[model samples]
Structure formats: C-alpha cells, structure tokens
Target: MIRIHEVTRRFGDTTALDAVSLDIAEGEFFALLGPSGCGKTTLLRVLAGFETPDSGTVTLDGRDLLALAPHRRPVNLMFQSYALFPHMTVERNIAYGLAREGLPRAEIRERVTEVLDTVGLTALARRRPQQLSGGQRQRVALARAIVKRPRLLLLDEPLSALDKQVRAEMQLELKRLQHEAGITFLVVTHDQEEAMSLADRIAVLDAGRVQQVDTPVELYRRPRGRFVAGFVGANNIFAGRLLASGGLDVPGVGVLPAAAGDAASGDITGLVAVRPENIRFADPDGDADAPLQGTVLDISFFGGSSRIAVTVPGLDRPVLLTAPGPAPVAPGARVALSWHPESAVLIEETVETTVETTHG
Candidate 1:
C-alpha cells in the first residue's frame, strides 16, 4: 500500500507535479497515465525516491517512504530500456542485486534460479543480453528487479519497446506475473489502452495534475470532465448551452435531450460528449424519427467494425459513428443518427481548459 499526499515537485519554472495525491492498494495493478509533459513519470520517480518532492508526504505500508533513501526504500524501478548489463549472463544480471547486498553465493544462486523460472527464462539463463531477444532481455530485466522481492514494483513503459503483437502478449504476461508474485505494481505509461488493459485502476494525469482516477470501465462510461471524456476514448463533442427544457441548445444543431442530472436548473453553457458507439443509424422515413440528420462524408473499415463520418447541415465538424461490420451507406448518402438521452455527458467549458482528444 502507498499514500501520496499533496506531493509537489518543480524544476526551475516548470512544475512537474502540482500537489498530487493518491492511494494505491496493496497488490493492486495501478497505472499512472498521461501524455508527454503530464508528469506521470515525474510522479513515478518521486515514488521511487529518484526525485524528491518539494513538499508532501509519501507513506508505504504506514512507513515514511520519503525519509528513506532510494536503495533503502522497499521498491524497485524497471526502466524502459530494460537496463541489463551486456557482459553479464541472464542469471548474473538477475543475481546482481542480491550479490551487491552481500548475500551468500548459494542463496543468490537459489533466488536467481527461482526468479528465472518464475519469469520463464530458465532456458535462457546462460545467455547474455546481446545473445537474447528483446523479450528475453526484458524478462531478464524484470527478473533482476523482482529478485529482491520488494514490496512494490515500479515499471516505466515496460512494454513500450516491443512491437504491437509482442506488446499485447506482454500485457497479459505482466498481469499474470503481478498476480503470481503478489506485488503491488505501479506502472507509468502514456498508452491509454495499455493502462486500461493492465491496470486494475488508473490515474489519468494532465499538466502535472490528476484529472480522474477510476477503473477502466468507470473512466470510459462516466468521465468526470471534458478532458477526460475526450482523452480516454473516441467521443463526439458538441458545444452548447443548457436549456430549461432539460435539453442542450447546441448552436447550428437543434436542441438535444440531455441525461438526467446533467443539466443544471439555471442557464449553463457547456459541451456535450457522446461516444461514437452510442449513436445508431436510423431511417429517415421510418416510424421512429431521429433528431439528427446528416450526409455520409466518409466510411472507414476496421475489421469487425466501421467508422462513419457524417456532415450535418449546420455543424462545423463531421459527426462520427461506429457500426458493426461493413458500412451500410456510401459517401454522400443521407442518413439519420439517433442516440439515447442517457448516453450524453455534459461538460462545462472553461476559458483555460481544453480537451485533448488525441489517443495515446
């Protein structure tokens, strides 16, 4: 377990962490996710004792973690480069930590063997870093970090070096290893999908601040703010003012119904975010009339699903919708888009605030 309270770190004029606080449960697979310059890595470094916070408190299992030195802390950091010694064999690299601590040769060998088997690198134990593949070297690096059996493990973009297929495989592998090892994993990554797939809970950071912390399902389904809605997944955003009639009067587009409890009683202007998957194609001439109509501008096929971009009459940007299988209509075809009122999320617009929709 870990607790960070009002942690702030600054370098010159730049603030890396701005009074950030979080609680990580024991044996929890937690992820710190954000884009570059968002301070996810800085936060991880602070936790690892690599970087000290200007003011705050860090506690691990009720002990003062900030007071401990980097080596004395009950934690280990696995770098993105898989920093294994080139001259050392797999077993030697794994046992280096224990050896530095002056453990007996027999105990070091036993621990190294156990860790190699745990990471499924026993067969490659005799191979050097240069002699092994990237994945093998990564396992060696992991083995090295975990051989000490620290209470907490810090992984900085652990799977970023691998290709798509290998990254996917390692995602599951990391999850399995975490469970088997029963160590609390705190991973720092800019990849949203990776965090969602691997972490039990994720803390989304932006501009040195924590935007939202929640499970993958909760973050996707109930994003707290405009930035979170746009960042975590694909969402169609509409800027508008809330009307007293329980609907949002979006300029260009007509008023659309809002989810209950989203619209405030007084006059409030904000943005409405709707996931692409939540929108359905409807027939204009059918008995059930949809509120919005648009001309199909483009259709993109993505294996089992298709993305349709529609150009509405008054909307500035094309509305995007996702449907299963092939696209139902060609470009320039007229179509109606319908969505449930409950699916819409209201986001208040602020002068200094902007949403980053680019996926990590």
Candidate 2:
C-alpha cells in the first residue's frame, strides 16, 4: 500500500500540490486524473521519490519514502515519452537493470527472454527504440519497468503519444498486465473516459488540489458540485432562483425539486445541471410539466451517436442533447424537451467551486 499524508509541494511562488492525501491499495489500478498543470505529474513524481513534498510525508508499505532516494525506493516510473534508449536493442534495454546489478550473462538472457515474451515483443528483441512502432516502444518501456519487479508502478500519460487505435489496445494490455503482475499501478491521465474505463478508483485533481475522488459512475451520477457535472460531460445548466416554496423554477427548464439543494426556497442560489442524455425531446402539446420548448440550432454527427443544439427562450446558452442515429429536428425547427426529475442534480452555485472542482 502507498500512503500520501498531507503532501504539499511548491515551486517558487506556485503551489503544485496543496495538502493532498490519498491511499493507493496493493494490486489496485489507481488513476490520477486532471488537466495540464493540475499537479498530476507533480504527484506522480512525488510518489516515485523524484520530487519531495514541502509538507507531510509519503510512505510505501510502512517505509518512509521521503527518506529514500529515487533508485532506492521500490517504485518504477514509465514516462509518457517511453524514454527508451535509442541505441540499445529492446532485449538489452529490458536487461539493463539486471546487467547493472552484476547478474550473469546467462541469467540476464533468460530473464530478458521471459520479459520480452510477456510484453509480446520476443520477435522484436533485436529492434531498437527508433525501429519499433509507438505502441511497441510503449510495450518495451513496460517490459523494462516490470523486469525489476518493483512494488509500485507509476505511469505518467503513457498513452498520449499513441494513435487512437493503438491507445485503445494498449490500455487493455496495460490493464491486463497490471492484474497479472498483482502490483499497485498508479497512472496519471487527463482523459476522463480513460480513467472511467481503467481505474478501480479515480482521483480528479485540478489547480494543485483534489476535486473529487470516487468511482466513475458515482462521480457522474452524484456530482458533489456543479463543476464535476459540467467537467465530466456535456451538461445543460439551467439558472434560476429558488422560490419561497421548496420548488425550483427555471424560466426555461421549469420548476424542479428544490429539495435537491437541501436549502429551503428563498435560501437557494444554485443552478440545476442535467446531462445531455438525460434531456429527451418531446411533443410541444405533450404535458404542462414539459415546458422546455426550444428551437433547433445545430446538429453534429459523431459516428457512434449525434448531438443537437437547441436554443430555448429565457436561456442564454444552447442546450446540448445526445440523440441516436440522426437528429430528429432540422435547424429553425421548434421542439419541446423534458427530463426525468432524478436526472438532474442541483448543487450550490459558486464560481470558486466551479473553477476549483473541474478536472479538465
């Protein structure tokens, strides 16, 4: 297990990490998710013992990591660039650590063969880093890191360099390898879908602080604040003040459950956020409860699905709706939209929390 207790880091006047604390369980694939300059990389470096925290401490399996050097720590890092030696062949690169440890040539050859086979690179053992494809180079990096049998593994944006197809394949391969090795894998990534699909748990960080850390489904369904809902995906945010009664009245979207805010009527000041998929197009003459009428403004094709932009009266921003196959309405067409009561979450509205909580 890896423990991060009140870790804080500062570079000059900027604080890269602001008193963050987390625990990464053994054999778990823990992901650090955030945008660029959100301190994900800084946290990874701290875990790898390359960067020391200004406050608090990092411990691995009861050993104080702050007291050890990078090489002395039982951790290995796989850099985003794959950082393979351009001149060395794949086999030699994987065996370099063992060679430095003064292992016999025969032992090094056996271990190298096994690791190459494990990463599906046995046939390309003689190839240099420059000679292999992007995905293959990444595999070589993985082979190098696991050959040492480290207690914890750190990956810093390891898939950003690959093409989409290769990235998808490598993501599954990495997940499988981590499970087979039964080691704690800590990955730093900014991609929400990646974190959702591959992580046992995700820590969403932003501006050197933790926004929300939980399972993907929980984060999506029950966002603690408005920033998380908008950041995770396309959201239709309806702005309106709370009524004296416990009911939410959006001029365009209509009255929702004021109880969602936990504040009584006049005390509520937040907006209601609903996901694009939750908003359904309805007939204008449907029901009085379906008062969300809008004009179709634009449509976009996304191969697997499509998105429609609708501009409604009393709202400044267009609402994005996800529709299957093709859009049902053309531009300039008037449409009615409705959503289930449970689909939208009403969180407190503060620009500070919005800016601080969103990961990407």
Candidate 3:
C-alpha cells in the first residue's frame, strides 16, 4: 500500500503537483491519468524518490518513503524508454540489478530464470535487446524490474512504445503479470482507454491537481464536475439553470428533465452533460416525450458503431449521438435527439473556478 499526503511540487512559476493526496490499496491496479503537464508523472517520481515534494509526506506500507533513497525504497520504476542495456542479452539485462546488489551467482540465475518464465520470455533470454521485437523488449524491461521483487511497481507509460496491436496485447499481459507477481501497481498514463481498461481505479488529473478518483464506470457515469465530464469521454454539454420542478431550464432549450441525483431545489446554474451513447435519434415530427430538433451534420463509422453529429438551433456546438450499426440519418436531414432524464448529468458552474484554485 502507498499513501501520499498534501504533496506539492513546483518548477519556478509552474506547479506540477498541488497538494495532491491519494491512497493505493494493497494489490490494487491504480492509474494516474491525465493529459500532458498534469503532474501524474511528477507525482509518480515523488513516490519513487526520484523527485522530492515541496511539502507533505509519502509512505509505503506505513514506512516513510521520502526518507529512503531511490534504490533503498521498496519500489521499482519501469521507465517509458525501457532503459535496457543494448549490448546485454535478455538474461543479463534482467540479472543486472541482482548482480549489482551482490547476490550470489546461483541466486541471481535462479531469480532471473524464474522471472523470465513469469513474463513468458524464457525462450528469448539469450537474445539481446536489438534482436527482439518491441513487445519482447518491453517484456525484457518488465522482467528486469520484477526480478527484484519490490513490494510496489511503478510503470511510466509501460506500453507507450509498442504498436497498437502489441499495446493492446500488453495491456492484458501487464494485468496478468501483476496478478501473478502479487505486487501493487501504480501506473501513469495519459490514455483514457488504457487506464479504463487496465486499472482497477483511476485518479483523473488536470492542471497540476486531482480532479476525480473512482472506478472507471463511476467516473464515466457520474462525473463530479465539468472538467471531469468533458475529459473522461465525449459528452454533449448544455449550459442552464436548475429549476424547482426537478429540471434544468436553458435560454435556448426548454426545461429538460434531470437525472436522478442531478436536480436540486434552489436557483443553481451549471452545465448539463449527456453522453453520446445515451442520446437516440428520432423523427423530428414524431410524438416523443421531449426532443431537440436538429439538422444532421455528419455521420462517422467505427466498425460496429456509428456517430452522428447534429446541428441544433441556439447551440454553439453540434450534439453527438452514438448508435450501433449503419448510419441512421444522412447529412442535411432533420432529426430529433431524445434521451431519458436519467441520462443527463448536472455539473455545477462554479466547479471551474474551484478546480482553477486547486490547480493553481
């Protein structure tokens, strides 16, 4: 387990981590997800003792992690570059750390062989980094890291170097390795889908501050604020004020019904976000409960699914709808977008300023 409390790191005028705190449970696959310059990697470095925080403390299994040197800490960081010695064969690369630790030759060989088997690279152990494929090289790097048997493993974009197919393969591979190794994993990545698919829980970051931390399903379905709603996935956002009748009233659109927990009693103005998949296409002249009429702008196909963009009156951006199978409507056709009230998520308007303050 790892714990970070009020950790802050800054570089001149820019702050990389702003009083961020988090907990990683034992054997949990946790992910730090955000865009570039969001401090996810900086925070990972702080945990690894490669970077020091301006304030606050880091503890692993209740030990003061910051007090120990990088190598002394019970943790291993797998860098994005793989960082393998080009001339060293896979076996040597994996044995490098144990050898440096002055372990006996027999012990090193045994551990190296065991880890090579664990990572499914026993056959490639004789090959050097240059002779192996990118995925094999990555396995070499991972085998090298895990051979030391650290209590925690830090992965910094571990799959970033692999091709798309290989990356997808390694995503599942990484999870299997973690389960087999029984070491807690804290991975840092900017790819949302990667985090969603690989991590048990994710901490979404932005502008040097923690935005939201939850399961991928929870974060996607019930985003706490506008930034989260916008960043986690594609959403159609409408600015409006909350009405007493359990709905949101917008200047351009009528009072739209709110999702279960979205409605509040007083006068509150905010943005209402609806996922594209939640919206359905209907005939403009049909007798639906409530529909927003719009002109179909375009349709895009993605194998099994399709996305339709609709231009509605009084809205600056087009509304997007995701549906299965072929295109439902062609461009320049009039359509209506409909969804259940439970599909909408209301995000308070002041969340932007609050996020700004925390990030600053």
lDDT of 1: 0.85
Comparing 2 with 3 on TM-score, the higher-scoring candidate is 3
Q: State the C-alpha lDDT per candidate.
A: 0.85, 0.81, 0.85
TM-score of decoy 2: 0.91
Write one digit per residue (lDDT tens) for candidate 3, span 33-75: 9999999999989988889999999988898999999999989
Error of 1 at 255 (Å): 1.9
Report the lDDT of model 1 for residue 348: 53
TM-score of each: 0.93, 0.91, 0.94
Given candidate 3, what's the lDDT at residue 175?
95
Question: Which pairs clash inside model 2?
Answer: none
Clash counts for the predictions, in order: 0, 0, 0
Model 1 lDDT tens row, 1-360: 899999999999999999999999999999998889999999989888889999999998888999999999989999999988999988999999999999999999999999889999999888899998777788888889889999999999999999889889889889988998899999999888999999999999999999999999999888878778878888888766655556666666677667544345565667778889998988877824576888999999999999999988767678888999999899999888888887877655533222222211
lDDT of 1 at 336: 89
lDDT of 2 by residue, 153-256 (tens): 99998899998999999989999899877878999998888888889988888889888889888877777665566777677766565455555566445565
Instruction: Please tell me which predicted candidate would have the highest TM-score against the true structure.
Output: 3
Candidate 2 wrongly placed segments (more than 4 Å): 241-247, 251-253, 256-267, 349-360
Instruction: Show model 1 residue runs off by greater than 4 Å.
Output: 243-245, 261-268, 349-360
